[model samples]
Target: MENIFFPKVVQAVAGENRTVYAYMNDGSIRLVDMKPMIKQGGIFSQLEKDTFFEERLTVLNDTVAWDLTGEHDPTQCIDIDPFTVAECPAVADPLEIVG
Candidate 1:
């Protein structure tokens, strides 16, 4: 029997150019660019604001999420699927290079 691993985001850091660095439980970091989604408007419109996008960035439901209400309620947050995030190419820790 083979064990299936499900990716879960343990931490998330908002970056310039509307990118998010997702730190996964599998010890991998995935970069998610939210610009495409934000361009689609609707619920994603709120994230268009740079301050709001960075401030609300968080990890919820084990994935990258935005806490719109600042209440930390999973139901009220906008979250990306962990599997979708995991599909992104893995990258080295950006913080390491910056520091």
Candidate 2:
């Protein structure tokens, strides 16, 4: 989780893109998915539709600094692109996104 949730807090720049982390139910922070995206595919399409999160943590005395990510990320676990996530974010996270 240290790598995901416990990272140092950062600010969102108007013209900058950076890594934002999320916390899992396992008391661990999820890892970043640096994989490239698929241009055209059903899974890819879904990722493009989900809402991703942008969150901040309480820096008082927490073990790992993580809270609910702001938006949603459909592609978080699936093998697809961010666009698929942008489509449907409210759906529960699945352990596997494959058929």
Candidate 3:
């Protein structure tokens, strides 16, 4: 897919069922359902624990990131590509974006 722009993530909230609400620089909010990605295993497997998954999410480098703490290598941080995540169907309302 051709992405003309990569929206900078401004905020995010992780919700149950592996859903993530991403607020982007374009002023559009997208709900990213990660259950399918997590099922693929590998680094995403670390998020199997609901508490860790929900509480550890952060916005970094204009994208949703996880494992930013010292326990994990900074370079190993798991994040979605900003270009790929941009232009997702927007949520109807900002308040409805919450997990």
Candidate 4:
């Protein structure tokens, strides 16, 4: 989840014409546009599509051993659970928050 900021950043580099809606886990709101993040991959691929259907995401930032499993070092990951997250106030935050 990364506090919705990642999406905003991604959109800025991906789709300049698209609109951004930043929703905090606590229900706070923020708006942004996609005009600065596109060439680096936007909603088409780097977009965060967390909506229940997608789950079990991970964020690996440790450059040394990677994750506890000693596998690939994932920079970021968003566990999707739109329904439950939207419903449960305490479960809307990102799963793996290394930063």
Candidate 5:
């Protein structure tokens, strides 16, 4: 079976338990739970600190990412898999608009 994928992520917003990623195609949004990954404690350990985690949410081309170097270095970055994010459940009703 082949996997269907969404368009690349253009923006990401961090929240208490999850991060919302907005895709380029049709403005679709996906909510990814990052708590589990952050608890694993490896490269994600930096996110254990609330301020750092909330402040680090960034977009690295097509994925939700973090800039660990405190500089604009892509090499010292970490990001979630685009496919995984696309497959996760939506943060809210897909048809509803808050604005």
Candidate 6:
């Protein structure tokens, strides 16, 4: 039998230029650029508003999400798959880089 690993996102921080830093349970940080998705519009259109992307960014359903309702309702949030987030390239902590 083979063991399957499912990546779990524990925390998320929105970054400049529509990027998100996803902190995984395995202690790895993944950088996800949301510009492309947001540019496509549709459900992502709401995120285009100023500061909304960053303000609503959160961790929901064990993945990176945007709490559109501001009530932390997982059902009302927009979320990215953990596997997809895990596939993104790793980056050094932004705070550490700036410090």
**Candidate of highest lDDT:** 1
TM-score of 5: 0.75
lDDT of 3 by residue, 1-99 (tens): 987765888888875588788888888888887888889999899888877787778876678888647354547578888766675667754465566
Mind giving the per-residue lDDT tens digits that candidate 1 earns over 1-99?
Answer: 999999999999998899999999999999999999999999988888989899999999999999989999999998999999999889999889563
Give the candidate order by descending TM-score.
Answer: 1, 6, 3, 5, 4, 2
Sort by lDDT, top down from the best: 1, 6, 3, 5, 4, 2
Expressed as tens digits, the lDDT of each residue in 18-73 for candidate 4 is 42333533443333332233344533333333321122222223111112233433
lDDT of each residue in 1-99, candidate 2, tens digit only: 366422221221111132223233343333333223323544433333323212322221222222233223322233212232222223233343877
Model 3 stretches astray by more than 4 angstroms: 1-4, 68-74, 94-99
| Candidate 1, position 30, lDDT | 97
TM-score result, candidate 3: 0.78
Tell me how candidate 5 scores on lDDT: 0.71
Alpha-carbon runs more than 4 Å astray in model 6: 97-99
Task: Give a tens-digit lDDT track for model 5, residues 1-99.
Answer: 998756677777775555444454446678777878878989988877777776777877578788787685767788887877777776553445778
Winning candidate number (TM-score): 1
**Error in Å for residue 80 of model 5:** 0.6
* Candidate 3 accuracy as lDDT: 0.77
> Which should have the higher TM-score, number 2 or number 4?
4
Task: Tell me the lDDT of model 1 at 94.
Answer: 88
Q: Candidate 2: where is the Cα deviation over 4 Å?
A: 1-20, 34-40, 46-99
Candidate 4 overall lDDT versus native: 0.28
User: What is candidate 2's local distance difference test score?
Assistant: 0.28
